[model samples]
Target: MSAPPLLVHLDGGVMTLTLNRPHKLNAIDNPLAQALSEALSSAAADAAVRAVLVLGAGRAFCAGRDVSAPPTDRDLELVQAVSRQIVMLDKPVVFAVHGWTVGAGFEWMLDADVALASADARFKLPEASLGVFVTGGLTATLTASAGLARAKATMLLGEAFGADEAQAWGLLWRVVPPDALEATAREAAQRLALLKPEVAARFKRVLNEVGLARFDRAIALENAAQQALQTGG
Candidate 1:
């Protein structure tokens, strides 16, 4: 039997999905992304998963999209579909970030409700620096997290930041030691889950609307700005 693309574990109204690609730093490969999307959908409809926590099994949260395979239409579509689904999921999706977070793997959590970073974690938006102006909606999200000037510096300059720095800059809600990340995240999720599941989920949905619409607007602004930068406006 083939190993699962992701691991799903549900307990006490909290569903935690582990991106189980430690060997590849849990990069968002095609199969893993599709499975992750489906898992989010499943957790949303289960009526039992009041809150969802997404994390990686090994050293990293996600090292971005797997560039091992040549970029293709299928690859792009899969990632895009999963990203949209992540944004559409009603349940709150929290992330536990460790190691490197880049590319689509970073995009997946960009659609999350909240993020907790390990002290050792580092984040960078290298899409533009890689000759690709925009590979994901992260420029906007990261900008929203850290502000326009910081966002521009990070994305355009391809700067990387430590976890505590991320929190101070508003890139993450919280940061903890590497060993404490999972437990801390789980405790936080469980606290939210202890409340009425339906109510919690509804709150998540409403907050998503408020946050995501702004997120879209921010991304649009970034996109237009990026276009101008590339087009010599």
Candidate 2:
């Protein structure tokens, strides 16, 4: 039998969500995306869960959607929903990224409050190359993170960048040695988890109110653009 696509564990007020499917580099198939959405929803409702940590099970963080299977509208919705959940959650979300973080995976990482990447991590925006636009509010998130020009270049070029370059572009909070990546990310998450939940939630609410005011609008635009591109409009 195949292992579940997502593994969830709660310890010390921190919820660790691991993307399984190492063989596929933790690609976001329909099942995996749905699982992630459910897990995030559960975490949000649990008072004991103060912070959430997202990590990849294998070498790569996530290589984007599973291309082998034709993605349906439901798949797209599920993927977008997971991204929205991550952003709307009052609890902090920390992403420990390594290896390849491409397409939707990279967008999801952007939604995280704290993103820690391994020295060996690589990132790419493959939407343009795939003849599709980005979804899940990345159009705004990337621009907000790295400025309009850099974000456009990244989306247009579909080029790969190393962890250091990503940090320089303001996409990552920190890049740690590959060996220390896990420990550093866990420490950060634990520290956030130790904060009072109401205090953390209040801060997050204000941050989103100011920084992500247009997040929903951006997602709507992205979804429309992606659908049109998929339909060859």
Candidate 3:
């Protein structure tokens, strides 16, 4: 049997969720998407978990959804669920991105409370080129992160940007050397885990309320657009 697409481990109050489909560059498929959503839901309810850390098992953080296969409505729902969980969870969620982070995978970084990238990391939104649009509130989040003009250029052009460029655009909190990526991300997660759970939750709640007030509406819009495109409407 094949290994699970997601690997879960908890240590020092930080729960790490690793995308394990290295051969596929950790692409998000139906099974992987559902597993990720379930894992995040469980992590949020675990008292011992103070923070969640997401990482890719191999070179790429995630190459986006596996378009090689036909996608189901359930797949789309699971992907959206994971995005919602990341934002709604009281516990901090940190994404440690490396290599190729594109499309839905890039949206994951935006949904995260904190994002750290390696020097080798590259980000892109290819939905426009793929004849679809972004979901998971990325329309709002990307605009907030890089401004309207930049976000428009990115989504429309579907060009790749390096870690330094992403950090400068406010998409990443930090861009560490490739060799230091894991260590820096782990340290950040550990630090977050040290915070009082209630305090952290309160701060996250306020931040989401003020900064992402339009998130739900944006997701709804994106989802409709995606479905329309998929159905050739």
lDDT of each: 0.75, 0.91, 0.91
**Candidate 3 on 103-176: residue-level lDDT in tens?**
89999889999999999999988889878878778988899888999989999999988999999999999999
Residue-wise C-alpha lDDT for candidate 1, range 1-233, written one tens digit per residue: 86777999999988999999899888778889788778877876788887888889888888887778755556666766666666667666788889998766666666677789888998876766665454446655666666778867776787776777878887678889999999999988888777786676688668767655565564455456555655568
**TM-score of model number 3:** 0.98
Name model 2 segments beyond 4 Å from true.
Answer: none
| lDDT tens per residue, model 2, 138-229 | 98788888999998999999999999999999989999998999899999999999999999999988998788888999989888887887
Candidate 1 lDDT score at position 50: 79
Residue 16 local lDDT, model 2:
96
Q: How many Å off is the CA of 111 in candidate 3?
A: 0.4
Instruction: Give the number of colliding residue pairs in candidate 2.
Output: 0
TM-scores of the candidates are 0.86, 0.98, 0.98
Off by over 4 Å in 1: 133-136, 214-233
Per-residue lDDT, model 3, residue 122, is 92
